[model samples]
Target: MTMPGRTRTKVCGLTNADDVAAAVDAGADALGFIVDVPVDTPREISPERAATLVGAVPPFVSTVLVTMAPIESIPALHERVGTDAVQVHGDVDVGAIDRLAGDCDAALVKTVDAAKPESARAYADAADALLVDSTDESGAGGTGRTHDWTATHDLAASLDVPVILAGGLTPANVAEAVGAVDPYAVDVASGVESEGGVKDHDAVRAFVSNAAGASADGAEVSA
Candidate 1:
């Protein structure tokens, strides 16, 4: 996939309509709602709530549901929430993802822990995009700690799908990240949050601004 000249921003873990609106107003290309049950994070929302939040978003703004469940759950979620995409964050098999792709009829974003590059590659083939994240054996993301960017960079370089850099990205270092790895997009949760799952609006704005600035510089260089 070609690298995007403007780094797309995905604001994850939104539970309410206000948060969803905030992310959209902050120039987010995509908004993620955590639907993982047995609730890993404080931002986890029910399918009904997710539907309400997704409804609040305007057209052209993508609504993505992040889940760790099997592909079987996607249909019901998609039917109710009307999501534009699904971000799978777990040990889901590629076949399952392919099944999800066919069933949900939405873009698939397969997330792999930064520690497991091999597994990332295996999933990348089946996904529309790959999200390189921090390791959390508990099945919860947004740890507020960065992983090895070099490893993610190498993985992105080798992959054919769009690589969305995640795992503790902040405004201060987002430009550096864009310069170093050149991901198709950037996903952030705790990095732009005042607390786990609660977004900091200014932080979100700053992060997007920095990424856009970097993209401008990158485009200029290419031109």
Candidate 2:
């Protein structure tokens, strides 16, 4: 199968099997399933449901559990959800990242809020990848708002691992976002949704297509 050049795409907040299948068929490199969180998002799914969703995914497409559960609950959560990765967010501490990394076999993804840009630098080396997100008053991610990409540009340049840019990304503006931040990957939830927790298939196709084209352009320029 032909793929996008280098930049990866992850479709977050997927709820049902149809959306999951659509995302994978539309060429998403990864899929995010929100679990064990305090704040209310229309997309949040229970560990059991997430596991069922993860089971249906075919090979090569990663399943990431976007969780805010306590550090101690991680291993069991991963065991229950059967996710390939766990994104640690909401009052995350460096120690939590260390513990999660040590205790779980799944890939570790750390979320750094735009409100705490300096925190990104601190967690840069801790996780497999850093997901840069916009912060709301509640401190939960998937805010569907954009951050200062200039700061992200600097952060991505300094990081040893890849950075996945999120927040307010849509098919219309993702290309501009990629040009500014030049992230290793881009994540979208609301950007491609037709409604809360429901993905618009056409939007998904356009988003992946645009992001891949931008990634290709970036590669040629660097080459």
Candidate 3:
């Protein structure tokens, strides 16, 4: 499978098996399952459910689990769910992120709100990737608000690890995002949702198509 340049797409907040399949079919390079409980988003799936969804994914397609702060149970969770990558959010320390990656043996992604560039950078050494998201009062992801992409772009340039840009991304604006930030990946949830956790298939396809177009253009420019 040819890896996309510029911005590979990650369809996040997937719940049902059908949605998972749809996301893959729609050309998502990765799928994100929310493990953060008591959240409003539709993507929150139980460990057993997540395992089932993960199993359905084909080779080269990544399955990512998103968790909240205080990553105490991540080791066991990672072992049980068998996810390709783990993303931790909320008020998590850099040391906790390091331990989670080392102990759990899963690729780590440390997420920081776009407002907090310094905090996000603090975990740059620990995490395999950085996810820049919008600040939310609920502490759960999938909010439609956009962060400062300019700041995120600067952050991505400074970091050695890959940066996954999130927050308020849609088919219309994703091309501009790729041109600006040049992220390794772009994760979206509410932007493609018909309602909260439920994904609209057409939206998903459009997002993937737009992102692919942007990636192709970026590659041309680089070449």
lDDT of 1 by residue, 17-107 (tens): 6677788888999999888555457878888888988988999999898887656987787788789998887677788888878888789
After TM-score superposition, the amount by which residue 13's alpha carbon in candidate 3 deviates from its true location, in angstroms, is: 0.6
Candidate 3, residues 128-178, lDDT tens digits: the string is 888888858655556777777777878888878888888899988887787
Q: How would the candidate models be sorted by lDDT, starting from the highest?
A: 2, 1, 3
Give the Cα-based TM-score of candidate 1 against the true structure. Answer: 0.92
**For model 1, which pairs clash?**
none
Model 2 deviation from native, Cα RMSD in Å? 3.4
| Candidate 2 segments whose C-alpha is farther than 4 A from its true place | 1-5, 216-223
Worst 10 residues of 1 by lDDT: 214-223
Distance from true location, Cα of 103 in model 1, Å: 1.3
Candidate 3 has what TM-score?
0.91
Best candidate according to TM-score: 2
Q: Once model 2 is optimally superposed onto the true structure by TM-score, how far is the C-alpha of residue 213 displaced, in angstroms? A: 0.9
Collision count for each candidate, in order: 0, 0, 1
| lDDT pick, better of 1 and 3 | 1
Residue 202 lDDT in model 3?
92
Model 3: residues with Cα > 4 Å off, grouped in runs: 1-4, 215-223
Q: Judging by lDDT against the true structure, name the best candidate.
A: 2
**53-131 per-residue lDDT for model 2 (tens digits):** 9999999999999888888998899999998999888777787788779899999988889767788888876888888
